[model samples]
Target: MYISGIGIVFTRGRGIDSFEKALKEGWREPSRTGLIPAYRVGPETLTDASLSKKIRRADRFSRMAVLSAVDAYGNSGITVNEREKLGIILATAFGPHTTTFSFLDDILDYGDANVSPTKFSNSVHNAAASYVSAILESRGPTVTLTQFKLAFQNALILAGSWIAEGRCDHVLCGCADELGMVMECACKMKLNIAKDGKINPFAFSDSPVSVPGEGSVFVMLSKEKGSNNYGKVGEISFSQNITRKPDLFVIDTDGMSAYETGYKDIINYDTVIAGYSPVFGSMLTGSAFNFAAAALMLKNQIAYKCIFQDNPFGAKLCVETSAKNLNEIYCIKICRPEIKTIVRLQK
Candidate 1:
């Protein structure tokens, strides 16, 4: 399937303009949590009273998911009629944590009988996808999935199958995560963060980088290529074997030491390696943002620099060298303990 359009909202900013700008500039400014460097898509970014009049009462997760999907749909230039034929696949690791906890608080404070009904309704994992469907008025299949770190990858696999079976003309697929105080506290307790508030992906550190980030990314994909198509997504596999070397390599090195080892062992010495976690911070659903970055790089013919790390011995870092003849790109997503999913994209 071909990616017709992409929408991203992250700690850097919103839209393609902000995404590209952040890549070019690198990470000079990032929010700090205690000593850890954190990335966040400001709640104010989606809280415009005039723009979000309809979803003003919706929780942050619903607002973020709806806005990201709407942005992708608008960028795809897919009309309302066309959108009716578009299916939605939303993958999330931590869905509506803020609202979920709020409901829990209500239940504890007022008991089940007096708990807030609105919070209770929005606490489910599928609420974001439901809100997206309602806001978009999409009649096609809308599915929400959650599988820890591999949520987005699993969603992509399902979406590709749906398109192959002629289930829908197009599919809006992506992953989203919202930052919550409870999650951050858990990360701080379980993981280690850099003292300088910066993440170094290349170097080996004794302490793992525990910075938590949150955002949403949506891509409009179809079986046929369009005038605005960024690139073609072909053959998403959970199996780890690869026969051909890609022109560019995008690795999900999110400053977590555990996920970095397997990628380091697999990547070729001469292949060009690109990393973007410094700009977006580390999150379970970060691969969704990484996939968006790969599409942008293929479309623009310019590879953004890998911040905080030098180029490998035989490989060229995107910042110093140009990716001029990029035709195929490989994106590796490592979903903790043993799961590794590889996605192949071509121009």
Candidate 2:
């Protein structure tokens, strides 16, 4: 299936233009708690007037997901009536942690009987996906999955299957995650935070430089080609040995040794190797953003400069510099020594 449209929101901003500019500038915001830096999507991006009355009641995670799906649908140029044929699939490492923790706080402070019912409603992993379907009025299948680092990749596999099986004409597939105080603390305890509070993906650090980040990205995928098609969603697989290398490699290196080890062989390959984790920061669903960036680059026929890499930092693509057709892009997801999922994109 081809990617009809894309709506991405990260630390930089929304849409393709903002993401490309931020990629070139390498902008990131420091956390207030003085922990690792995080790429957070602000709450003010969606105003009260933009959302419906029912959608306004949703929690932050659902709000982000809804807005992203809205943007994806808008960009796809599909009619409102066609939405009934659209399915909503969302993937997240941590779904609405802020709301879940608040519900827990209410139960701990008061009691289960006196806890906030609204908080409890939005605490489940499927709450955000439900809100997306409700806001879009989509009667098609709505599913949510949580698989730590490989959540987004797995979601893509399911979305592709649904389209192939004639289950839905188009699927609004997305990956959304929201960071909370508890999650932030867990990151600090788990990975190494850069002392300078900056992410350098290619830097030779003695310790892992994993920064926490959160955002949402939704893409419209259809079996038929459209004018807004960015690229085609090709092969999606999960294998231990990746024998064939792709034209471009989007490695998910969050400074975690386990994730990094899975890509060691391909990391030093002669083909084009691009890492954007430093630009968007690191999160469980950060691979979603990486896939978006890679698709954008493939569509634009331009590769953004990897600021941290040693040899080629700001080299623009030319016939003399790189290949003519950047056909395949491999997005590899690794949890530890095991390779969980590999999503292949073709232009």
Candidate 3:
């Protein structure tokens, strides 16, 4: 599948321009105003006057997904005469947990029968996908997937299959997750929280430090190449054997896993490596964010400097933002040294 456009909602800002600016600005501290240091998407960033009245009752998770998907469609600039040919696939690790908590609070504070119906409706895992499809008016197949790991990658694999099966011509493939009091409490009790407000991607430690984050990223994908292309996503594999070499490698090592030392095994001495968790914060579905950065480099023909470059392993990192010839780029997500997932992007 080829990338026609990209839309993103992150802590730094909204839309592709905001994402690129964050890349150029390099490392910035996470918000300490929350229970923990997190790259939480602000309420102001999700406000869209045009969409406010339409999605007035939608939750934050659905709002992020709707905005990102809408932006992707707008950025593609491809006039779709047939909305039925457009598909949507939304992947999330934890879908709207805060909404569920709110519904539970209503039941406890009031009564089970007296709880708000809107809160219950928005708490489901597929609510984001429903909002995306309803707002986009896409009649094609809409799927919502939830997995702790490889959620985005799995969604990509399925999207390619959907096109291959003649189910849809274009797919709005992306991911959305939100950080709230529930997620914060879970992260504190389960993972190692970074107190210093900086994620050392080079740490590569067994007990990796995590600064929890939440956002949404969507890409317009099609079987055929379009006028504007980020690159082509093909040869997606779950096996460890990687044959093709790329201009550079974007590794997703944001300290979401228990053992992140496996990431170092894939590093070659010649190829430069980059990890962008510091810019976007830590999430299980961070592969989507990393892919966004790689797509920008290929589409714009400029490599952004890597942020938070603390070279513990002495790995050759992309620390400079300059114009260069980038024919190919690979966005890799490694669950373990033995089990690896790769998405090869060709110019």
Worst 10 residues of 1 by lDDT: 310-319
- For model 3, how does the per-residue alpha-carbon lDDT over 1-347 read when each residue is reduced to its tens digit? 89998999989878999999998889888999878999999999899999988789899999999999999988888766688999999999999999999999999999978999999999998988898898888999999999988999999999999999988899999999999897898888888899997887877789888898999999999878888788988678886576766788888888888768877765653677877888899998888999999999999988887787887887778889999799888888878666688888878
Runs in model 3 with CA error above 4 Å?
none
Q: For each candidate in the order shown, give its overall lDDT on alpha carbons.
A: 0.78, 0.74, 0.88
* Candidate 2 per-residue C-alpha lDDT over 320-339 given as tens digits, one digit per residue, 9 for 90 to 100: 22223678887776665555
lDDT of 1 by residue, 1-347 (tens): 99988888888667877888888888766686433457877766776554477686688788778878888887888664765567999999889989989998988898889988788888888888888787788888899998776787888888888888888778999888988888877777676765566776654333446467888999988878877788999888885666778877887777644656566545455677787888888887888888988899888887777887743433456655355777888888765445778899898
Task: Report the number of clashing residue pairs per model.
Answer: 0, 0, 0
Cα-based TM-score, every candidate:
0.93, 0.90, 0.98
RMSD (Cα, Å) of candidate 2? 3.2
Predicted model with the maximum TM-score: 3
Error of 1 at 270 (Å): 1.4
Candidate with top lDDT is 3
